[model samples]
Target: MSRYDYRVRRKLFNRGQESSHKDFNSFERKYNQRHRIQRASRFLLILIALIVLIGIAVFAAKADNIKKKSAPLESEKELAHTKNPL
Candidate 1:
């Protein structure tokens, strides 16, 4: 009769608790685990790719320096050959 409904609240609070099965497949939990693994794998892949790219850039820079240092010596050798006329 009053605005309060104790019987209704109690029925809702304890209703069908025992009747529920323990299957608990719980779709959200599986999705969360799968999503976490996917994210971790993607991050790891990106990290490895960045490391490989950095290594390649370092090697390319070193190769350029080596070529630059050798080019001058090659030009000098060519000049020497021209002066010798042989």
Candidate 2:
């Protein structure tokens, strides 16, 4: 048989061969815990950034509204001054 055609055999684990399996399970658990913490922190960072952006947008809108309201009052004052010659 050619080397390329030969299949490598996988070792079978018996009931007494549980050490490797337990080690792999512990490693997998630790890896999953670290991955979960990283994902949660990333999500929280994005949430806080979005909240800050929304707050800035709200403040900007309020400032624009204040400017608009003041403009009409100034125009009304000018009209009164011109009509009263003062």
Candidate 3:
């Protein structure tokens, strides 16, 4: 074959290989982006659930404290005594 024809064939093969690589690279990038979004959404859901649980625990604790504080204190002698005859 002529030198010019050989050069043209070589350049064409290189371009085809490069295009295939580009196609796979773009596919990988899109897959990674979609996976990252899913991961982010899962993390957000977990974080929100943790926050809600913490809020519920805090509210229950506060309610318990308020109830205890509102109750009248017993006398020292009464505290030591039980509901039985001496």
Model 3 clash pairs are none
Winner on TM-score between 1 and 3 is 3
The TM-score of predicted model 3 comes to: 0.51
Error of 2 at 79 (Å): 14
Model 2 has how many clashing residue pairs?
0
Assess each prediction's global lDDT (C-alpha) against the native: 0.80, 0.83, 0.78
TM-score of each: 0.49, 0.53, 0.51
Q: Higher TM-score: candidate 1 or 2?
A: 2
Residues 1-86, candidate 2, lDDT per residue (tens digit)? 65687657686456565555568778999999999999999999999999999999999999877844435577898888889954
Question: What's the candidate order when arranged by decreasing TM-score?
Answer: 2, 3, 1
Per-residue lDDT for 1-86 in model 1, tens only? 88976464434545647745444566678878999999999999999999999999999999877844435577898888889955
The residue-by-residue lDDT of candidate 3 on 4-61, one tens digit each, is 6434343445643555556877899999999999999999999999999999999999
Task: List candidate 1 stretches off by more than 4 Å.
Answer: 1-25, 67-86
Lowest lDDT block of 10, candidate 3 = 6-15
Could you say which candidate leads in TM-score? 2
Candidate 2 ranges beyond 4 A from true positions: 1-22, 68-86
Model 2: pairs clashing at backbone N, Cα or C within 3 Å: none
| Cα lDDT for residue 32, candidate 3 | 100
What is the overall TM-score of model 1 with all chains considered together?
A: 0.49
